[model samples]
Target: MTAKLWIDSDVCMSSGRCVADLPRVFRFDDEEIAELVPDADIDAEFDAHRDLLVAAVRNCPAGAIHLQEDGVEVEA
Candidate 1:
């Protein structure tokens, strides 16, 4: 019913692209890892900045970003 983004902790290389791209939706912890806010709406959480999310995933380098919709994984 809605869109979502998942970050693979293991694959994340701490590039901080997610946080820089979608600061409202993602945050960097002390360890420089990206953390997604729980229960946060994909639209609202990222301030309707879908491009930023897309860019983050595309430039992830680590291939840790996963986009999904309604419980189904969606290709970037």
Candidate 2:
């Protein structure tokens, strides 16, 4: 399943886990908040790295990472 992913910067704590762990899918903005990488093919990433993506979400200290499939929030 193709899932949509996003980071809630307001809730992000600059933990850097996602950015460090999944550079292709996430990066830190100028303000150091995590954000999705520009032009990232989230679907393909999800397809190829489902386990890693889920782990990232589960490991995010601020719970700022989010994934949704079919309009429902994924539970990591």
Candidate 3:
């Protein structure tokens, strides 16, 4: 019912776009891939900043960002 953010670490190129756009919601792990903030729920945050998240995803060079709801991918 709502778009939730996630990153495919395997596909991420460590470009830091997501972290640059939204450091509060994204981080770089030890492996240098983009990762979500620990213990955070994207579905909950999506309501307030859906547009921002979409923009971040769109800017990802590696196309590693994804949005899903109910296990189905959502079109940004």
Candidate 4:
């Protein structure tokens, strides 16, 4: 199944990796912290690019990105 995604803004380091690597799923907020693109269909993205999403979560330097499936957090 598709996973749910979010970012912990407080922990975000503004590295821009996710935004640069997956613009369709992520973007920088006004303060420059990475966040999920508001209009993105997360389910569709998870279904289509699960590996990339997992990589994003794993690669986030600040460990700010999160993902869940069936309400259980997905570990990087």
Candidate 5:
């Protein structure tokens, strides 16, 4: 397991960049805003889509997404 990921909604621009990069890991709610799949455990899910997760973070213009490992910061 690597790290968990979280997106700060307050800083999110609703760009959907993360959603587009990782459709299986992200989604857009009815409001057309980006949202993580409920209860997602990114550390466990990392192996399958780490690339996409990284890509999402890289693509996010607001820089709202963050990754943490065992409660330690991994990405800002």
Candidate 6:
């Protein structure tokens, strides 16, 4: 199974790296903070763009992005 990803907005620094890294999944909300699109299929996105998502998590200065699979948090 793919890892389902999400962002912790409170921890986000509006770096935009996630947006730059994965447009299909991450986007800037009204507040300009990086967040997942409302209708995004986290599992599918993760499956397709695992590399981009990994880059996002690695590039996010605030370390706000995270993933889960089967209710267990993913760390990568």
Clash count for each candidate, listed in order shown: 0, 0, 0, 0, 0, 0
Clashes of 1: 0
lDDT of 2 at 67: 92
Candidate 3 wrong stretches, greater than 4 Å = 69-72
**Tens-digit lDDT track for model 4 on 1-76?**
7578999999999999999889999999899989888999989988888888889999999999999977889886
Error of 6 at 1 (Å): 0.3
Q: Residue 24, candidate 6: how far off, in angstroms?
A: 1.0
Candidate 1 vs 4: which has more lDDT: 4
Q: Write the per-residue lDDT of candidate 6 for residues 17-71, one digit (tens) a residue.
A: 7787678788998989887888888778777777777777777889899877677
Model 2 poorest 10 in a row by lDDT? 67-76
In order of appearance, the predictions have TM-scores of 0.75, 0.93, 0.82, 0.94, 0.76, 0.83
In lDDT terms, how accurate is model 1? 0.75
Among all windows of ten consecutive residues in candidate 4, which has the lowest summed lDDT?
67-76
> TM-score winner among the candidates?
4
lDDT (C-alpha) at residue 8 in model 2: 86
- Model 4 steric clash pairs: none
Write down the lDDT of every candidate, Cα atoms only: 0.75, 0.90, 0.81, 0.91, 0.75, 0.80
lDDT: which is higher, 2 or 5?
2
Error of 1 at 76 (Å): 4.6
RMSD of candidate 3 to the truth, in angstroms, is: 1.9
CA shift of 11, model 2, Å = 0.3
C-alpha displacement of 5 in model 4, angstroms? 0.5
Estimate candidate 2's alpha-carbon lDDT, on a 0 to 1 scale: 0.90
lDDT of 4 at 41: 94
Which pairs clash in model 1?
none
Q: Sorted by TM-score, highest first, which candidate order results?
A: 4, 2, 6, 3, 5, 1
lDDT of 2 at 72: 83
Best by lDDT: 4
Q: What ranges in model 4 sit over 4 Å off?
A: none
lDDT of 6 at 52: 76
lDDT, candidate 5, 1-76, per-residue tens:
6677877877888988788777766787787767788867676578776777777777789988887656776553
